[model samples]
Target chain A: MSTGAAEAAWQPSELELSRRSVRRRASTRSVVIALISTVVFAGVIGLALVGSPGWAVVQQTFFNLEIGIESFPAILAGLWVNIQVLVVAAIGVAVFGTLLAVLRSLRGPVFFPLRALATGYTDLFRGMPLLIVLYLVGFGIPVLDIFPRLPAVVWGTIAIILTYSAYVAEVLRAGMEAVHPSQRMAARSLGLTHAQTLRIVVIPQGIRKVVPALMNDFVSMQKDVGLISVLGAVDAVRAAQIEVAQSFNFTPYVVAGLLFVAISWPMIRLTDWASARLAAREQSGGVV
Target chain B: MTVLEVRGVRKRFGDHDVLQGVDLELDAHEVVVLIGASGSGKSTLLRTINLLERVDDGQILLGGDDITDPGVDADRVRARIGVVFQHFNLFPHLRIIDNVTLAARRVHGMPKDTAHARGLELLGSLGLGAKALDYPDRLSGGQQQRVAIVRAIMTDPELLLLDEITSALDPQLIGEVLDLVRQLKSTGSTILMATHEMSFAREVADRVVFMQGGRIVESGPPEQLFDAPVEPATAEFLARVRHH
Candidate 1:
């Protein structure tokens, strides 16, 4: 009888209904506060910019919709060059960087020379500024009559691959080291040759662990592919420069910059999504 | 027949000798358990046999073959022995069935279909059939350890080395793993294990070897070692473990 009475009393009463409304109100209040803050932040920034003395001149020079639309076709064409260089250099760097990392990680006295060579390559390339390397390889190689007829764009791509591979190799090496020593032991004890262990077990895990880092490099590479315009490769930035010189308007530069961001934005989102997924997979407890 | 023999094995890390002239042997169908305190060279001895550690001075004979010879193929020798580590080191990226079939397929060059079928059969018999497609991280510690055992025995290795396999498991999960080891023993598999579970050792080991200060103090049948240890060091070790 007492249990039945307690069950009867557990039904939604006026007090419980009031408590539910209180919780709902608290959530609604937070959302309202957030919306107000966002609107105020945007309004203040917009008002200050519009009230500036040079607003009209700045807007006419850099934000002219008519000039932006006119330059879009040429800028889009130039962006194709950037995409090609990025795609080619991305593949080149992955292959070259993995080889360098493996060479550096080899054991025994027999590998000392190869290890030293790999280390020297990474140090030399990583120490020099990418711009300096690009200038030397892009301009100097032609003067030396080595591959004299090769296009400047090809030389620029090579320079990018050489510099970026060093950074990527270091990233890969760190990933390999981060794998616990026990993993190597587990693989080796399975009767796998050292090379087989690396190929089948260690390298795959290392590459997976460093995917976000690799994607970050690729995003940065997308912008640096523009650096090739210094070699007279006629990429987006160079095309934008040509437009600005002819029209005396900077709107073309803005269009080109927006294109770069448009390309990289999805990649950044992808990196975030991948990192979150990996974290969630790791944190989920095992099944019983 | 004597399947594995270790003679005058010595290993040193810097100036400290980890395994000081240790000698041991395993027959074709026997279980030898090593029990010792931490830093007593139990793990080092096991690693030396698998050639993960090169002994400073010793010879390990596997079926009359001198495996420690400089010219011997280490990979070929390792294929004949199985090992299970303390932490159930299953590859996190692989499915449970793939982990079991890896050595059979890659090292032994078994056909893919044959390897997978054998792997599934082993998992099914072990009550892990439903988990064959699940990733290692999706299995419990006990289940992962069992999968490791299944992987180790996939190729019918001549000797199995189990290094504190149950040490990292929870008390509740330890029984399941120990039960698998007992089952393997019943099938006449030769096993050499290092463990800290004294009662389990007493129950499962045909012979118990006690070590201290990088040396085997005493070894005999479990009845003699557990009930009446001959060496003072063995008695002291047993007393401390029993008190806990």
Candidate 2:
């Protein structure tokens, strides 16, 4: 008990203090060098871009601040549509993707047909380009008159959900497969049914192992939601198209691109931070 | 009464026949220890009995019930048996008490309060009561193995299968885990255990079964099997193991 007080009172030797300062100074020097090099790099790139022969035309078309300011409100209104679609699509992906992953993981011959179907579904969706899927689903479904004519956004949302769940399910399957077989054996030996083992033991560990990967898909999903514009949803991309048609300036498209980047940047940073924490925890080899 | 009857079981993985027409039986309250070299099929036999593995050919009777039939519910059969593994496969996300009591509450439909009480008391008797709230990763290897034992016995299974439980522990930690097994044996739990520790086998087993190359070479009471082996392979194995 007394050792705690003694340990707390202990101090570094002079040599240890010098080593600490040496490490601190080395990091500070690197930071300063990086800042100088980055500024110089940007300056060179800027000068080259400005010195190009068509700079005047490019600026008038793509960097028109007046047009960007004028189109900002409409683009912002359309962004609300993109946000709503992203939220709904994300929930659908989590549920449908997990069900697909569980199906793929089934063990016996009795589940072979289901396993094959789920596998084929993922392969078809993941391999097909998203643009083609959007066009086919967007234009194709209404022709069948599947129900009373619905808004194009509903079809567009369905297309995105179908494609993205393939991706999410694969990531989750990788995570589930990474879980050691012994865990499953232990759960089964304890008399838990296969479904019970998956719910209580396997899937929880699987999801944890792939949190960073899941976050990457989530960030990618935010941008793809804008693809709904192709179906004439008047989402941000569509709103930007209107401004571009009226003024014949490409500035609104650039504005829309920057808006997408603005929303996605925080999630990108979060994914990196999560990846770092996961890596650190995994290196310790004891984290559940 | 015979607690388990494994009749002419066979298992194959790739070209290797892991269990080659093996037969084994354990009577109620009989502590049988299986001694074998690596890949001798002892562990495979235990796994098949628990239905963690499917046998290519055989019938496994647990208390006269034909458990190997395709129509038989494997989960309900497994509920009547307890098993511990070499690596102490405790559920990593759960607390020690949750790991101990999960089967009792989930599989058997024991109420949460009653299961918790039973789990805590068992952990207490095993010197692990204070560590109940901690995760398995937080415990030392010996402590984790003890918790695994508690998890195994929580349901009072008709038979217990221990597959090299002490093989993964440090030398200093092995005694604590073996002591718990000794306690289980004294309490008359019908146990079929596989072990590499020859000395512990001598001390704890009522009967010793020697297996070689996927077949039971010989078996008898511990003294007769260890001291006066009838099979040349059995004596050769004992000599080689003891020489090490």
Candidate 3:
């Protein structure tokens, strides 16, 4: 496989060579353009901020490296709380939300009450702000004294589940409805019971179809878990609040915010990957 | 012995009477074909028998059991019959093997190994043994319809209902499906099918039923129905089908 022998064996035509060169030039030009645009945008924003009159105060309060470093341990530990709440609430939301969706989608007169209740639950929770639900459940439940006093963290986690399950249920219902009616007809014609048809045929496909939307909701849920901090639970944001109160600096808040972004970035990428895979599968006519 | 009996089956979708006082019967080992124009109630009649559509009036009996009675369990009644539809109704998420084995395993409570073996046997007989592991989307439309037929027959129900099974197929593919149906007819399986393929009706049907305006206008042996139809509507419909 000498170089000259290989070149002779596989000689490129003039048209092919020109086309290759053109493609190469276009790619290189686009890369250069992208780089220049990025540099200009970043430099302009950086210069404007540095040239501003309040830069010194803003930098000292928000970007102090020492304060950020000091806050890391507490914020990281508090982030563990957010993680626990997120994982538990995610599981709870999936189960409760699917149940609500099933109830809402039931047909005939026998399930009318259950359907109404599910509709009311979704409407009431989805209409109210997550923070208000947090306030009501976090403060209101313990005061009622009907149940034993649970930790504020537990109450906060409940609030997140309550609000998110409503949205997740709606997403699940939409996915289930999107399954063609022919599927149900086929299942029933095969002698599968209504329950069996839903379990064995419909729900599995429906859930797969909604995976991207569910992942999107889960990512938002990771952030909403931070809202639990308003209940005095020591989640990352609450820890940052404590640090800011003690030091009179906002750098800890910035650190906590960055940590939240760090946590959600992987999930966002995961959702993008899942959606792309789904699109590709559909285009190729592959099974879900 | 009669395998299925439909007595005065009536169905209405809003104001339109889709099946108006339809009465039909199928004897064991008989292959009956229903032919009609679009919206002529062929599908609605089959659907009513399968319990996919509730009849507004009349009783449907399967092997002397009044299946359309309000107290009757639809699921249990459906288990005793097999049905294929106009579209390929294979479950998309499942492999061909699983799709075939599902009703046998779940409804009949057949063992998994038994179902798998039976599914493989059916697929192998149909020249689809290698595709059992593949999902429905991987197969051609004709293959998918064949799998649907296999799935329907897995439980060996008392009767099989096919609703325009070969209509969705390409012209080249229709023969393979029709061949499978013909093979089933030879096996003494009782079938009541609705189809637009007049040639198939001529070949496989022991009795050819003609429907128009949601009513059975005429029915007889294929020779009488196709070559010597007594009813003007039947002759006109067959003439139109032949013109196309």
Candidate 4:
């Protein structure tokens, strides 16, 4: 670290330093301009909002600081339940969807029944609304007295798996089918069997192609985990409901909504970033 | 001796006939270049020869065996032929040397060490030895195509089908791949190639076959065909290609 004088490459030339300084100054100026514009626009909107006639009543009901603070602990605790359900449901959807995709991908007249069944399952579940599935599974399973009366959270997780797996399976199948027939020919020409070709060559490439689409589904799933609160699960939304009832104010609901935005916004941005990166990678191949 | 004979080969995709009763032949150590517009069925003809596309009606004789016969094993027939595609079609995930050796080792049962030795030697000769451990995408487009040529030939198939191998390359990169093909030709590998490069065909090909509407319109020595094309379609195609 002390050998700076010996390190000839460490010094940039005067002209180079001047060029870099101009670029840096331009960047700093743009940052200042952007900050000024954003603050001015936000200030205008804030003044308009506060200047409205209903501000006093609206603020007392929806923006009560005391109620929001009091309900934060319960809402955070309930989010832990959503996280557990999300983890289990994500694994379930991946395993079940892949199996269904494999079943659908089987060739020959002999496996027509399996293909038809897998196709029918994806069509049926993808068509059904997630809320209705939750209601039916949440209510119907308990009525059947299945396995000593499972909790609503368990049933909600199951319902999510049933619905989301259909989406995942379809995405995966599209990926597999989109793998060019030429690639198969290339593999088979090397004397690989149809099954061996799919395993070794086709499936891996297929999964790679649809990774961006798969990440979109993952981001969507994070938002829908909030819906589990409807099935009498003490998840964030339900916890907010209990808090709002006790306080007789809308601030608790606002807290829950903001918490969800905070949790899922970064993932939504991440999916967008990944999609752009994948498109770039496809165009110019390097580390995929 | 005839290495390949295509007799009355016809292939149809839906309502459009891709190959309309075509016949051609190639001898040992000979180079036949197919030149035509994009949809003239030269690529489809190559695919049918390698058994990637089934012929609607025809006979293809590879070394006196009727390969187009329904009972013939397609994979076995394909293994006996080498193909270099326009897009370089290299397996992106595999290292350059692995791509070269995979088919030779898997289908021909060549031992790993033997295949690797040959692979490295061939790559080294082509100026790709230092890149042996890198994946296909890491190399330039021209280099990847050279690697593909290596993959196609390292197995030493009886016949080689090059389907528009340089069409997908950049203008500057095209020469690198063409040079490799020229090198392959000097080594006496029998090749049936499809290309848009008229000059390369004139220089390397024993015969140039011109096609129009899935039919071979004319065929002769490159000098006879390119300089004194008998068919109007052939002359017009040549004029258009030269204008470009």
Candidate 5:
């Protein structure tokens, strides 16, 4: 078709074409505005960083690259701890949260009470500040003589599980409910029991459907583990804090932030890759 | 002896009575087709047989065993009776073969290898063997419905209940799924299908039952029921459906 004929066929009216063009222009303009704003904001932040004494100290401390090599073992250990905390907490949250979600979704006389209880648990933990929860678990529990002998690491782990389970449960519940009711009915008609169907079919599909959300959860959880350092957990942040005290300088905190960025940056990229792969799989009607 | 029986089956959804003391029976290897207008309790009756939807007051028997007994294991009863839903209801997460084999493995305790082989054989018979590894979303409506049949039969059930299995298919696709059902009849599997397909009812069914307002209005051999329906309601229903 000729360009004029094709354009006419595609849009059909001058009004529609004008409206489309207006929207396209508006979107492009907004994108340009956002880019400019971001550049300005980033430049200001860079100037502030350059003017700070911490930057000079950071430069001086890392002036000998061999110092980094010597401290590699400590840094590696801290990184491993971060990973371990994330994986253990993630697994706990996924399993417990799924069970709670399933229990919340069950019907009949038991549904309301179970739902209310699950809701209460989720809301209570999720609504509280994570740092407060960590403090309460790590300090208040001992004062209250409730598991007084429990270590700070144990308290921190509990705090992480409690706070994140609520969030993860909601994500998983949304994923579970996204599956069509027809799928569940099909499972029932096929004579698979409810538990068997969930284990073999529903949860697997739900988990796949919520991969990106789960990855986001893990990424955030990794950052939140740093919060536990305030309770004397020897995480990367706590180690950096110790270094800052010894050097009487703030450079270690920046190094710690970089360390965190190093951990979360790959996870964010993984989330993007996983999200795209999931979208592709959904388009192809299979798991990628 | 009747392979299936539903007697005094009454179902209520809160205050509304869905099935008001309905009664029906199916004999071994005989295809009994239920013909009805909308709200005639056909689908409800079929669902109650498998206890997917429980009846408020009723007794359903399968092979002389009272399935609705107070202490009876409902799952065990359901496992012995196969049902094909109108929407096909293929589990989208599973492959076509897995959809079929799941019941055999879960309900019947059949070994994975045996269930897989039997499921594949059933799929092959239904001309869906090549698509066994493909997910349900990859198949056409008719192919999915056929795989539904294969899934239902995987437990080697004594009776099969089909709820308007072809109603959701395109007109062109309806024949293919029905043809699969027609092929199934020759295998000597007892079937009780709820449908509005007059030609299929007339040609394939041993008995035709006409229902209206949640009751069986008339029933007879397909020829007698279709050619000379006894009740005026039956005649009117047939005429109305045929007109549409």
Candidate 6:
């Protein structure tokens, strides 16, 4: 009798069902809004160019463009200059970055001020836009008579080193910090000097972790060589700019863009592949 | 001869005191186990002996030399006293063989071949020779801790300070590490360990010292401390930890 009475009293509550339905509708509205925005963005881009001369000219110059077999030599020459700039600047940054990182991480008397100075240097360069840094180094420094006889190409190279070293130092610092405090304790307990422990253990692990980041930084520096055009340095971008200036046509700008893409494409793809490989190895138990 | 002495050791962080007026001594070839609650300053004391922690106020002596003296060369003294931490702070970047051989070659000026051979031999004794080329992460917690001990002993320090070396191991694996420590007792090496394994302490330690609130509340032969502790605090601590 009691079970039958309970069954008679049972009824589906409409308020609870209605509240759940309201939440579902609200969530669907948000998703709908998001999708509508994406479509609207595409529509805006499509409409914005329909009557403009920019895209037509871009398409005509880029699609119909072809460098003669003779012009290939000049393109190759520019490519070589880009390679040289990247290699030299990367080497300089490696040596300079390691020295600065070590000094920053050190303790005791001499290192404190050096740490501050290195930190200030990293911050000053990193905070400034790369173009501004290039401009300052390339044109402004010569006015001060420091490295007065140095070529514009040398000044551009210096700008790359200054900007990239700041980034590399932070990468190196993260690697160093990843080493556990207990390892330092164990080293000290073994009666090994601070320098000895750093040289043998901490630095090796740190260098390994920072390798990918360093490579990525190097790639960015390679691309930034494009900015050396402002100094009239004869890199790939400058070569294209000079060619475009003579003809008053925008084809060389597109060609310069293509050159950048050519150089950066392989580097980007290689870093991506390297990162994936590293990630796979890490998942399989490679040390960080 | 007294191998280690700590007098009026007091350590504080901010307004809180971690160790208060602590005094301790370790004789030659003695195996002392320091038992205490977490944060009782037992680990702090051991670290201070290695100069890994600078004591706020105290004097520490090793083999009649004042290690706490401002003029003393801490690195030289540390070379004579090896310490193994709870976490086997092995250099993860280096192979197990390199981790063990590095200090021997760098600090003691041992040739690479000699250091490599000794490292292999030590690994063999620990039953870890197969993993000598592997990184620290590849080894189990117990295996890594054992490797840490070998790395420390490769330096051949006169005294070894083991700070809760087996505390991090799984219960089943704790036995193997403690067994290695028990076997080490027979090697005539002076050892001071901060351990949670009560039965292991009774088995291996020549003397058992119970500490609470950063002071040695009671200490005696392992039999007496384990069987009928004189202090209530010691008895209470043993009762709490004996179940584990």
Please count the clashing residue pairs in each candidate, in the order shown.
0, 0, 0, 0, 0, 0
Chain B structural similarity as TM-score, candidate 5? 0.97
- Could you tell me every candidate's TM-score relative to the true structure? 0.93, 0.93, 0.95, 0.76, 0.84, 0.85
- Span of 10 residues, lowest total lDDT, candidate 2 chain B: B18-27
Best by lDDT: 2
lDDT of 6 by residue, B1-244 (tens): 8898989988888998888888889998899999989988889888888888788998999998988899999999998988888888988888999989878988889999999999999899878999999998899999999998998889778899999998888998898888888777888889999998887888898899888887889999999999999988888888888766
Q: Alpha carbon lDDT of residue A273, candidate 1?
A: 96
lDDT values, one for every candidate: 0.93, 0.95, 0.94, 0.91, 0.83, 0.84
- Per-residue CA lDDT of model 1 for B1-244, tens digit only, reads 9999999999999999999999999999899999999999999999999999998998999988999999999999899999999998898878898899999999999999999999999899889999999999888899999999999999999999999999899999999999999999999999999999999999999999998888988999999999998888889899999999
Residue-by-residue lDDT tens digits, candidate 2, B200-224: 9999999999998999999999999
Worst ten in a row by lDDT for model 4 chain A: A188-197
Q: Rank the candidates by TM-score, best first.
A: 3, 2, 1, 6, 5, 4
Error (Å) of candidate 2 at residue A173 is 1.8
| Model 2 error, position A211 (Å) | 2.2
lDDT of 1 by residue, A1-288 (tens): 999999988879899999999999999999999999999999999999999999999999999999999998999999999999999999999999999999989999999999999999999999999999999999888888757588878999999999999999998988888778888898888899989888878888888899889889888998999999999998999999999998899999999999999999999999999987877767786553
Residue A64 miss distance in model 4 (angstroms): 5.5
Candidate 4 on B202-237: residue-level lDDT in tens?
Answer: 999999999989999999999999999999999999
Off by over 4 Å in 2: A1-6, A51-53, A285-288
Q: For model 3, how does the per-residue alpha-carbon lDDT over A1-288 read when each residue is reduced to its tens digit?
A: 699898889978999999999999999999999999999999999999999999999999999999999999999999999999999999999899999999999998999999999999999999999999999999999999998989999999999999999999999999999899999989998889888888888898899999999999999999989999999999999999999999999999999999999999999999999999889977887555
Chain A: TM-score in each model: 0.88, 0.96, 0.92, 0.85, 0.73, 0.74
Looking only at chain B, model 2 earns a TM-score of 0.99
lDDT of model 2 at position A48: 100
